[model samples]
Target chain A: MGKPKKLLNNPVDVVTELIDGLTAACGGDLRRLDGRNAVVRTEIADGKVALLIGGGSGHEPMFPGFVGPNLADGAPCGEVFAAPTPDLILDTLSAVDRGRGVLMVYGNYAGDNMNFDIAAELAEEVGIVTRTVRVWDDVAAAPLDRITDRRGIAGDFFVIKVAGGAAAELSDLDEVYRVAVKARDNTRSMGVALAAGSIPETGERTFELPEDEIEIGMGAHGEPGIARRKITDADAIAEEMTDRILADLPFSAGDEVALLVNNLGATTCMEMLIVARKVHHVLKARGIAVHRTDVGSFLTCQEMAGLSITLMKLDGELKRYLDMPARSFAYSRA
Target chain B: MGKPKKLLNNPVDVVTELIDGLTAACGGDLRRLDGRNAVVRTEIADGKVALLIGGGSGHEPMFPGFVGPNLADGAPCGEVFAAPTPDLILDTLSAVDRGRGVLMVYGNYAGDNMNFDIAAELAEEVGIVTRTVRVWDDVAAAPLDRITDRRGIAGDFFVIKVAGGAAAELSDLDEVYRVAVKARDNTRSMGVALAAGSIPETGERTFELPEDEIEIGMGAHGEPGIARRKITDADAIAEEMTDRILADLPFSAGDEVALLVNNLGATTCMEMLIVARKVHHVLKARGIAVHRTDVGSFLTCQEMAGLSITLMKLDGELKRYLDMPARSFAYSRA
Candidate 1:
């Protein structure tokens, strides 16, 4: 269709402009790093183990939107679908670092991993201790034997939620990192794409499919999915997605978990909720107990149409941290 | 495009299934009313002036998602884009009504107004007292002299927020009604539609427009708008929308207000944020102070592609209630 319509100006400046709008929406709770495409909390406590979250920009409310009270201490943003540069990440690292070290959490894309690692080395050179936990929760991206190869998806929210709480309460950065790793390890996600979203700069669709087909296990940024088939009802989709996630984690009977049915971008809340209903049904039949359920748009691929289901197997510590109060531009708990 | 893709089973059953899923996501904070397509808070306080909000089902998270602490006590749902029946509304009213009274707040659509009013009268016959506050916030829907004819849009959230807070805090039903009326009067909103969403049962688009054109002031259900024009950038659109809302409410330079940039489904967060930045810029230039700003999908028209800007001029009492903590399925403040 004639170049996917977008309400934007100077699309090359979308990342910066969106950051401006995001900070404005925050109402002074967050401020951008001067001359850098990054944001940090306005008031971080001294000696607090900082939690730093960052990623490419198109996924609104993921990295930048998550920076707030009881969430990430800061977020260094990259251009759309591109990882942040090492220098920008280092600058944000220094800004959010208190007397205690900072812990970096992000998706396990190669570009992000490399940039964040480089920044961590630079921070070490500056005597700022830091640890890293790359989230690889998308089971569709790789086999369980090579879990690190999987890409992070909506499960980033679960990892960030637990890590933010741990960073806030635990003085030691290592302890916070440990909890974040646990969160990442316990989470699993898989997505399907009914349609493609366009890029702001080019105004071109990211990918294309037939009118009545859907791609299962598709990555957020138009990566090829594991399977492409004709569109089906929500129950079958939900059952298949939940089955994959459950098998990956082997979430067995009586295992309480937090479930997330995240809208990829354009999927309506109605569709997500319908999927959520079937997912709950499937989980119930499998004898798994859902501790909590979240259904909304946490991470998105521009205006892409589809959704992903994420489940995080929770224990006592994870449940305590997950249930803590948080206030952010995108997510909040009370 | 090939009968607009939808993740649904038995579209006629969508309303009930979605409510089931919504209550599941609520984690025991909300439960459905027996034998009715409605939901109520599990533990509304004794002798409280209850708040009941409802409308059609397509605009999800509005009627159902907004039910929680410091929000509506219950919401009787209608089918997609259709008003709830009088019997269902009366049933929900009885379920949520405490001894004090019940306050009903909803959009000012013809069907909704008729149904809710009928229900209110029925409740009166049953020895229960109820008051109504119809939200007529769409400036494009009617002339200033005929304000009551305007259709409510995203401004429903602002009115509901104030009314919910007032109902919770005020012991007298008349005082709560006064506050809700004030909220409805102070709020104004306008929406522009880039594309249309489909009906679940028919799988047919609600309306159609040329690829390069947009309809300004279109209703959520594809009602005629004030103007149809070629696509434009965010700044021009935001300026025009903000100007209309400001002049309609006659918002003054010294007035303080809350700004909401709501997504009308399928529009990317980046676009919404860009619009928010320009709206803020426009307001700043006009010397209007924004007390708070919220940007997200509060109310949607099933996967419709567009956005709406809402302004609610605030007084001291309005500001206090607006800032109070609230938790719900779709919205939560901490």
Candidate 2:
């Protein structure tokens, strides 16, 4: 087992303790719903549309770190790598929703889709307005013809970011939902895993791959990838990952793009920056103008030593939302 | 080896490529000095005191990620875990100086002090005003009588953050230097290491420890800590770390503090938050009000799986400086 030792009590208690610690450490910016697996911003605007996003734990900052001002108003946290139950999502939506309604967004995982769908219906039964945009931006998960079937990966950051900003500024839920759908349409991503991250409870690697090799286009939760092969140079890996993601989005010459080279977990910024240079080389060679680039752990899979490259092709509308100032424990812009 | 595998090509080129990639990926916010091993904000306010911080590499977001308008005005980077050459620091000061002066700040390592001290003299000879503050806040490395000999760790974040914000708003170099000194004097930190992390160039673990144990008070670069023992509960570890740091500073009741639970590198946010809660509890039970709390990877030591806890006892003046808005590649507050 190559899995590194973890700092955890009982692995089963990881999520609950993580939430309690986060709420405590958050100063006064966040709070948890009583006896519920939901974390919400301390203050919700009176008439602003609420943005709620969640799926599983382990992907820190994805669900909880992002719940603050100028970001998601609330996060319905689930157990590690597992979807939140419908009942929990319902509780989150009801608590966060103001008169302006709510928007549910998260990765397009099967369990998440089923759970959130039911929760949305349950919300409406209580006369609360709610809509959703399940992000499907992982190009490797499916062919172009089945784009929507692709699993959501790190690109969930861009979609949720846009939705959060829009939800805060837009008066109506429809406008916020529209921006989320559009952001999802404009984003594409590809990932490569160097090692399988362990699940805290079992201390087990979710999957195994040969040493001196990496699996390109691997899903965050150890989902299948395109193939596993000998570890190549960073430039070659960057080129291949960039080529696949670029073509899927077909981000052509003259396109302006915001690129995010997200650390899957334990990959060093030293290595990520090396990869970032290769990404810039390929995109620049094609005459694409890179707009904003984020190179860090925007989303992670525990301590997986891998990275995901995500590109959000910017249009006038997407760029506007992307640039909006927001403050969260995870993502902050001044 | 517990260190996870890294992603890179020709590990010797990690630093150069990291600088290049960061320059390209920054999208206009940052740039590198021509013919110099330094990174600086693209625009420096004329006549404002320049704040420059740096040290050995591998600690991402420390030396370079903090270079921006609201943070350090510039960073002079060195080889991984090695101090920048005096010539490099001289070049950085010359390039970033906006006429007021430059403050050279970083950890109080032997190599760093020697290098920056020489650089300060060089800057003065070149007609550039310069001051220096070497953070010595690690409590485990020395007794209270020998505080000046203590190694700097995550406490560098609090010192630099206050200095940067003060430099931007303070009227002169002397004022900035005074505030930086005050902030440095008020900061303390303690860390624990669960596993060793590797250096890309050698791919060698920095140190060795038992798999089921942790070394309390370990330095960021695997420097010797207080003791190594069987793994303990998060709250217990937190209690020990907090008690030592608090007593070192004698941070008493009725004091307001800013807390930082920083991942040394690969520790999960889930675990960090759990630790954060314990840190908060320890401080709160003692009647200390945490004015602000930061729980994430501020400064890192590659892919090491561990964390450090830092506290800055904030006075009214320090709090005002810390609250000033600043934006950098890694840190942002709106």
Candidate 3:
């Protein structure tokens, strides 16, 4: 509620301390390039298109936890929701890049795009091939036609899964890029916030909303959204969110889709499943098939009280990759 | 706040729907015993000491998600916090039990223990060998001198992990029982609740508290905790919970331990890390070495606003088993 006194060195040191702690906790599974805020797992093998992703520190298991086998090769973590420097990205690419080039995948934020573009240029100059796929799955982030204007949310799960699986199979950079692009294009996400989040070092609320209301189109970093309205039942809220996402995606009857019911932050599995049930009904009413579903806090926004639904149209290739066996602390495929 | 709508067909139907959903989502990695609620993974090879573990339902990833290739042979899901019937447990044992016999491990709750005991008797009557190790980790649930009298919380993660690893390695039933007992003995846990959880069918809060206050030591079923206090700095609250856990366990200076900072329901990774940092600092100050650490929402209390910390005294065998590779939707060794 006031200046939150964190048990740390200082406000500026919070991010670095957290990163150091993460590095220590990961055992030998992860390695951070010297003098930079980027990290990569040791599992990256030879001659594969390295996938690099990151942006923000709090929504962990998202950018970093998703950096092991069949996922990304490296992640450049920034301050909470802040963009990492181009040098950090370059350093990360240098650490994991083999002869197989690299792909830079991240959210659709101007700061991230600007910095990653610079990193890509620098990487190219150094004789490493590079491509970028901007994730924009938030239907509420922008209008449907201008989907590129939307923000990336939980849909990053699908992006990481497809990109990682493609990389695992040693697909060429072009094919991996195409797969990543297709996954991104098929994903549609929207979120609702029930409460606010507080940045530990600053002890500041990322955004504000009335106690009795919720922001339906809330962004990950507490950005303002479509509108705030009275809180309704979980089913009603899930219905509203799913309807918006389904309409934006325009799935036909009997179309098979993979559902990702993700927690923006601290939403419970109980609540997530409630939303999942409603989503099941919503998709069923439209005759769209749900081939797979992931219900948990995969992509979170610090401790914000909210959730986002990401549905991707599942094709054979996508389903195959999504079903591929992989393991991480936050997610796994059978 | 009011009577929740009948999103479900009926209370008895919830478990079946969830079971069907679980099997469908498992991508053929999991299956339920015909006409029974018992679940087993397809990769469970014969001749192992069939490590079977389970408890109440609602702890989705806990009792079922943990059953897989390198884990338990089967899990019997109950209703809410209620224990599954002895017949249900017998069904699971008969489905997965090999000539190597079976070892049952579960929380120390009265209902669970009673049913498991009854199931053991039935197994013996049929000339089948069975044993069980009860997990008691919640320090607030009992006195320090009677640690085994405490309730089990998220500490099940460490216990199941070690037990599963031994079982996969074809450890004898006695060895499996020993490992389970060691984990349950060394493990200590404590919880703090920021809010209450709602029962899905009735849409009612299992417990209630003032807006500005939280209940410490609350159980998964929304029971009253040790005390209620106003929320404050995250570090202070983390220290409060950690202090109680450490004191109850009485870990000496230079004692090596593995820590599990668990999210009860909706706590975010950022907050979980904040709690972990504080706990780490506290232990580090005492010269205690945290050989391994895991922080996440492994065991949840629906959408309850809280978290629990589980500390296990580490040794060579415990560390090896804890470090063993695992693949589940909610956890992984790597």
Candidate 4:
């Protein structure tokens, strides 16, 4: 691939420029932190337990697109596929933190973990209470005994969504943290990659695979997966992936789940729907009830071609939070 | 290029299977018409002026995804990039029509115009009153004098949104048709394509371009556009596209409009945001106010890499209908 065609000015400014665009899109409801690559709600409620979500920038709607009513109060965006720096995170945390406290939720990644930890310590020094909930829901990354070693993927949407609601309604920082942790524990996701996305700065393909092969359980950034095999039918792929997720969660026959078929990047909505169809069938056959299904581009990896299936087992509390009204740049619920 | 590495079982069944998946994803709120390639709301109110929208497939989330509360009451889907047959359209029309009659909204294309017109006549013979409002919002396709010759692009979203709200609230089909016609008249759109998406049945690209070249004002199905040039910065592109759109409608300094930066298919959200940022700047500089902004994949051409900007000048009546809450598989509002 010769310099994947893109509409950009300077690759180095991708994060800042995109944040500027996102803030503009929000119609004055969001504002950027002064001299920092971060955004916060212009109307954050006083004394409300604030929800703070951040990660790399390449995943467009994830870190920033999700900042709006009933969602993250602020997001500190990082360089493409890189974690936000400690100072940037600290500024955003302080900006969104009300007198009540702040709850930080992000994917389970080493750089993000370190940076957020540092930011939390800095906030504590300044006399602001903060709590952290790292989401690790990708089952393919590690076995159940070592869940923390696994990476967080699209499951971050569920954790953030539940945490956002809890922060808005619960008022207590510890209660919000508990809700976020519960969401992370109940959510599971797996991804498959058919093609790789190009990096914004270099225009270089993230990874390469044989023309006819696909990597099952691939990471969003083209990390190695469990197996690489020739591409197969949508039904077969959905069956196998669904079975793996169901068995891993040990989701019982009567459990209810909110199903998500996330377009990793470039996969068409048609393919995602087909995969969702098969996954629903698999779930039905195994006696699992789908309380709701969301299929779209919640989290993406540039223009990489593939998708991930996420199932968040829902209880009355999780369901109430997930079903609550939300309005954001990337997601909304009636 | 080679076979496109799609996750499909049978290429010929792409439309049916996707419809199945969409209905399943709707959680029983939508159902497929018996033995027809169409879907309708399961709980349409009696004696309501029904809204029916349909068009070719390939644009996943467009026809079917828009079927739900406060949106299209039904949609008849066609094969990939092909218009639905008259029989399919008529069946869907009859299914959605209440005693108050039905209103049809769709893109302005030769095939769609012919099929929907025929379906309207067929419905008339059965005492089911029907009216049609074709969206011709692509300014790049034709000059102002020949507005009807233009192709409908992402502007269809605005038209359908207004019409869906009107049909649900207004008991008279003629009143609903008037609102839809106003929406179609006020909306304008233009698109640019960086890469072509493949057809599901045959891994064939809809169109081809040199690696570094981009096509501006291209239609959804690889239709010829007005300009082909080397890729440039997002600001320049956004400025040019927004200027052309503003000139077409002569959107005045004091006018307020709803803006949409729609991803045709594979373009990343980051790029769309950057484009949106520039468009907002241009609109502000010209003194035109944006009432609301939506950025996402509303209408797409499979996995084509490009986006379109749509502007719909809003009046009090238009704004009322546009702001109505809607719920669908692809779109939702709080």
Q: Which candidate number maximizes DockQ?
A: 1
Give me the runs in candidate 4 sitting further than 4 Å from their true place. Answer: B1-3
Clashing pairs in 1: none
Q: Rank the candidates by lDDT, best first.
A: 1, 4, 2, 3
Query: For every candidate, what share of the true interface contacts is present?
Result: 0.79, 0.76, 0.21, 0.79
> In candidate 3, how many Å is residue A111 off?
2.8
TM-scores, all models, native as reference: 0.99, 0.98, 0.84, 0.99
Backbone clashes in each candidate structure, one number apiece?
0, 0, 3, 0
Per-residue lDDT of model 3, residues B1-334, tens digit only: 3222222345555666666656655557778888677688776676878988899887666787788766788899888768999999988987788778898888889999999999999999987799888888888887777866778888888999999888888558888888888888888888888766667656687877776677778877776679887777667777788778777767889789999888777566655665776788888887889887787777887666678888999889998888788765456454
lDDT of 3 by residue, A1-334 (tens): 3322223345565566555555555657677667466778777777878999888777766787777777788899888778888988888988888788898889999999999999999999999899899999999988887888889888998998988888788659989899899999999999888876678656687877765778888988887888788776666787888888888878788789999878777565545555676788788888988887787777777667788888999899888888777755455454
Q: lDDT tens string, model 4, A154-235? A: 9999888889888889988899889999999999999999988989999999999889899999998888989899998999
lDDT of each: 0.92, 0.88, 0.78, 0.91
DockQ-based CAPRI category assigned to the predicted complex of candidate 2: medium
Alpha carbon deviation, residue B334, candidate 4 (Å): 1.2
Candidate 1: segments with Cα more than 4 A from true spot: none
- Candidate ranking under DockQ, highest first, comes to 1, 4, 2, 3
What is candidate 2's lDDT per residue for A1-334, written digit by digit as tens? 5656766767778888888887887777889888677799889989999999999999987888888877899999999999999999999998899988999999999999999999999998999999889999899899999887899998988988888888878999999998999999999999999988888877788888877789999999999999899998899999999999989878999999999999888888788888999999999899998888988887788888899999999999888888888888788887
| Tens digits of per-residue lDDT for model 1, B33-56 | 995799999999999999999999
State residue B173's C-alpha deviation in candidate 2, in Å: 1.7
Candidate 4 chain A, run of 10 with poorest lDDT: A1-10
B1-334 per-residue lDDT for model 2 (tens digits): 7435677888888888899987887778889889566898889888889999999899987889888876898888999999999999888888889999998889999999999999999888989999999999899999999988999898898898899989999869999999999999999999999987788788889998876889999999999899999997788889999999999988999999999988888887788888888888898899999998888778888888899999999998899988888887777777
Q: Local error of candidate 1 at B109, Å?
A: 0.8
User: How many clashing pairs does model 1 include?
Assistant: 0
Candidate 4 yields a Cα-based lDDT of: 0.91
